[model samples]
Target: MRELFTDLDIFNAIGIVGVSLYIANYTALQTGFVRGQGYVYPTVCLIAASCVLASLMQDFNLSSAVIQVTWITISIIGITRMYVLGVTSRFSDQERLFIRHMANGLPEHRARALLDNGMWLTADPGTVLTHEGEPVDHLSFVASGKAKVIVADKTIATSGAGMAIGEITYLSGEPATATVEVAEKMHLIRFEADKLRAFVQRNPDIGAVLEQNMANHLRSKLVSMSETASRAPVPASADAAAA
Candidate 1:
């Protein structure tokens, strides 16, 4: 048994270990134990690929070496991409809050990915976000300031920061029921409806989160409207009859 164990045996053992690591990583990902896009997954893959390459050095096999090299390259690329995304998507406290209603509970990278689909812009007071009776082509989130919801030249509701604009129309596949006009100088993140729909289709998890957020937002709006209605004074004509 001692004679059977040589330097070649040790190298072969390492190669076997490397193969085991690679398979384990893949199985973990396939079984949903690990996220494929996460840092740890790719890092493990990189280490496994390196070990396999080292083991191949003892007894050169061109095909095995080539596979190991390719694996290493792919793992390195994945690591780099993960790192870059992490660095670029770090958000400030206020910024995170601004997007929280829509992206709450999402993985950091996934939240960042959802935010990347929109363009940030500053709008002056009176800027029309959506025209009444027009097709809804985009959705916007108010990061700061306020907007007025107008229908047929009458203001109906006021939307403040953290509120969603054009969401109702965007979801309903109908023309804008009201015109959304900036009531104060505002910063907003706007996403093209078609592009956003495509992205949602591609990433169902993010899409699910977004739908939940929208539902919550709508519920809050309904509650607010109900409270406002409850507090409103009755018209004098109606009061006169009661008196």
Candidate 2:
């Protein structure tokens, strides 16, 4: 029994524990219990690498020690990057409120990353964003002001700040169904469709959040259209017959 509990056994146990931590952390990230871009995941990785390095010191394997050291370095870099982003990308009070309401449960870091793929611009009234029957090459989020959705020279709907413009066409890969024109001086964030798609491909979590947000926006638009239809006056002939 004394022979079984040697220094070698203790070192092996530490290595096993370190490997277990690495596996557990990876599983947590894959299962969405933790975020890959967050500090906790990388910090856990750093601890795991440190434990592995300690076990390597007892065994004195050059190759294994080098690998563990590299792992530790990478983990440290990841932790530092997350910390810096968290500190520097802190939103203002109004921006926080707007993001909270407009983003619909998107994390701040992810929101910042998404915004980084776009450009902010102000449009004068009567600015045509998407022309009817034309391909939508870009999408925009209205930070302030309003837009008119028109088809065949007749207004179909009014959209205001917090609304996503060109999303339907962007998602469907179709030409614009209606012309979208700025109805007031507007602040907006615009993203070229190709660039946005590339960014989303690189960061799938952001894509998921964006898809969810667009779905919610579409649902709300549908609800508003339904309400408008319900409130419309019946035709004179139809009203007379009902009476």
Candidate 3:
């Protein structure tokens, strides 16, 4: 085993596999490639293993050409898996709706701006959409499913489809006050915070849309909280009735 790994060719092959695996893993993990799907993790493992195999077998006698073929096959599989994940992921439906909804409210130029920044991807449960106290990098728009907004200890508000998130951080230019987590599989579109600021500075119309969306989101949350409060019993009133 030591000799096998010590050879320069083998080492280089291993290096190739290692770097490729890192790229693949980052792409999947950062971009929410495996949300709510069993195949994503398994596929990642398979690709990593294949890369190792390709590295180890390339120098063997009596089938060097065959080893190359296997390497190509593994790479092809990896690419295909990424495509499948993208096409069939949670974002498909929500992305369409996101485009349509934003289209109604935004002109073509603003719509293009949204994509030019960052865009939609699906995330799994337990994924931290954004962390409290982290520098705001991007603004995320929830396209589908739910996210938990942690306001205080044991106090959380769930934001669902069509809600805009991360704007508070963007507007305040401060670290997030609370963390956002994916409560379930969620599809989301995002815009780079810096790019958005620049765009907003240059184009007042785009800025207006962004501000409007933020207002709308705040209003919705307020309404939801109000309704929840209204449904709760007043302790003093209840005590008087009991007396």
Candidate 4:
């Protein structure tokens, strides 16, 4: 095997290793960055070893050298981005806020009232929390984990701990325009619409808190989407429509 490898061009060998490393780096990034499986590091290391082996060989070419360098450059950037993503995921404000909110929703005294009124906790990543274009039957709170609100095939926001999911539609008694999907394994607390309404009637303060929170969240999300769209480049078709 060693003798057969010796017959290959030195630069080509290095290039192959570099390409492998770059691929591994990007894959690791997609799978939750550094918190991902431990196998990516070992794969990267093996690729680096291959590059060293190639440098020791005799046959080398300009094409091989260029390919090898390109791979190395790409790998370095990919790995750096992976590390940055890991760091950001760990300290994201949105993530932290979700935790805080989940821990501190409507007072504990109100929880039983919700549960007695047909509210129950369910945890499932595969469950369809809400379907777009369908009438919402319940109001859901994120007791734990995260969910994405998808409107017209576009992701509107990721709701984390302490956030409610279906209040808008539940309150308006209208068909839902957005679908809520579990972005991560989530612990959802749900209340039947009729029961929720009864509880609100009895505990007006808690009801007000829930409504205000939902309205504020919607406003914040809209403002954020608008700002992001403003900063993004407009396609020719979109610009023509505006003109």
Candidate 5:
């Protein structure tokens, strides 16, 4: 071990660090901790490439130098494209909200692509967003409104801004679990079910984020239902039946 350290110059140490970073980044990417299109992905790769190139100055290797340079160039291009095209400063108010809230863990460009597939509009009070026992042909994301979750004509819970409607049956191609009625006028981005499903199928990463968002929304709705149920008075019919 002491003999090995004898040849380990500063440049070799830098090279080792760079190799470690490469392995770490690849591991993280495979584990889904960081997305390939996200800033961290290319940024880390760029740093690793730079470190490797710096080490090559101490001990020259033509092939290794060429590879490192190419890696650095690709990383720079990726980073530049992400910044130049995914300029959040130019995004509209709703797009910003979607990015901040609904598009969790997705790259901004991919989020925008998903957003482009939908139609943004305002829905009025008493509007039926989804019908219970009917196919959910569309999914609505509530941007700024509240809706009642109705099951068998009883309002069981409320879904507010940042929640998705008709998500329960989205992936399964089943009937909606409950009807959703707009209790307050709301801004919504509506996506056609067929198109959304196809888009998701084609983009698995986006699909994964969508599923996560839906899961979070569903859990919140469940909590709301639990609270509402806890507050409800015992029905007179139940007492009468017991008597």
Candidate 6:
């Protein structure tokens, strides 16, 4: 068998690694594995550029050096912009609370996109948020006040702050699972289904964060329901039979 390499210098190895990174990064972007909006892409490009620039010390190429330097400069600019947007982003109190609770890991810019697409509203008491078996037009996050989750006109649960409404139908494109009625006037963050779906399709990272948030909230609700069921008193007839 013939050997592919006998002796590879450190600088050449670094340059090869850089080439690999360049190829891999581009491939990841094309394959939907990495997003162009975030820091990871630019950071990887910066590192790759650095490696290629270092390799130029071993065997200089003016054109290659220029390309690498340009890549490095562009990458640096992109990274700096993303950082600034995340750091200098402004948010209101309800926005801050919503981001902290449901979309904690989102970059401020993306969080802003989400919040901007949604509207903040106050629902008066007796407002019908969702109707049973009807298509839900939007998703709601309760910033304040309370609501009842009703099925067949029976109250099954109370939704308060930090709870997500219509997330299931938002994901499934199904009808509302239950009727939600505002018992007390509610401050709400509402995202229309069409807009949210479009945004999520365009920015999947935000979708991922939202999905995770929904999963966590649903799990907690399940746990609370389980506890409530467990605490229910035994029936009198059952208790008498046990005695």
The 0-to-1 C-alpha lDDT of every candidate, in the order given, reads 0.84, 0.82, 0.67, 0.64, 0.86, 0.89
> Which stretches of model 3 miss by more than 4 angstroms?
1-96, 99-104, 232-243
Model 2 TM-score relative to the real fold = 0.78
Ranking by lDDT: 6, 5, 1, 2, 3, 4
Clashing pairs in 1: none
lDDT (10s digit) by residue, model 4, range 1-243 = 998788767566665766676577667656635322233564474466457446645555667556655655655666666555444544235334432443235433343333455444656675678899999988776767888878889886677776777777876888887898888888766778877788777776456556666677667666876786677777999999999
Sort by TM-score, best first: 6, 5, 2, 1, 3, 4
Root mean square deviation (Cα) for candidate 5: 2.7
In model 3, what lDDT does residue 32 have?
A: 52
Cα RMSD to the true fold for all candidates? 5.9, 3.8, 18.4, 20.7, 2.7, 2.6
**TM-score leader:** 6
Q: Write the per-residue lDDT of candidate 6 for residues 10-51, one digit (tens) a residue.
A: 898899999999999999988868888889899999999999
Colliding residue pairs in candidate 6: none
lDDT of candidate 2 vs native? Answer: 0.82
User: In candidate 2, residue 16 scores what lDDT?
Assistant: 81
Error of 6 at 192 (Å): 0.5
User: What is the lDDT, from 0 to 100, of the residue 238 in candidate 1?
Assistant: 92
Q: Name model 1 segments beyond 4 Å from true.
A: 1-84, 92-94
Residue-by-residue lDDT tens digits, candidate 3, 200-235: 777655566667767666677779967876877679
lDDT of 5 at 106: 75
Which wins on lDDT, candidate 4 or candidate 6? 6
Candidate 5's TM-score reads 0.84
Clashes of each: 0, 0, 0, 2, 0, 0
* Model 3 TM-score on a 0 to 1 scale: 0.52
- The regions of model 4 sitting more than 4 angstroms off are 1-122, 231-243
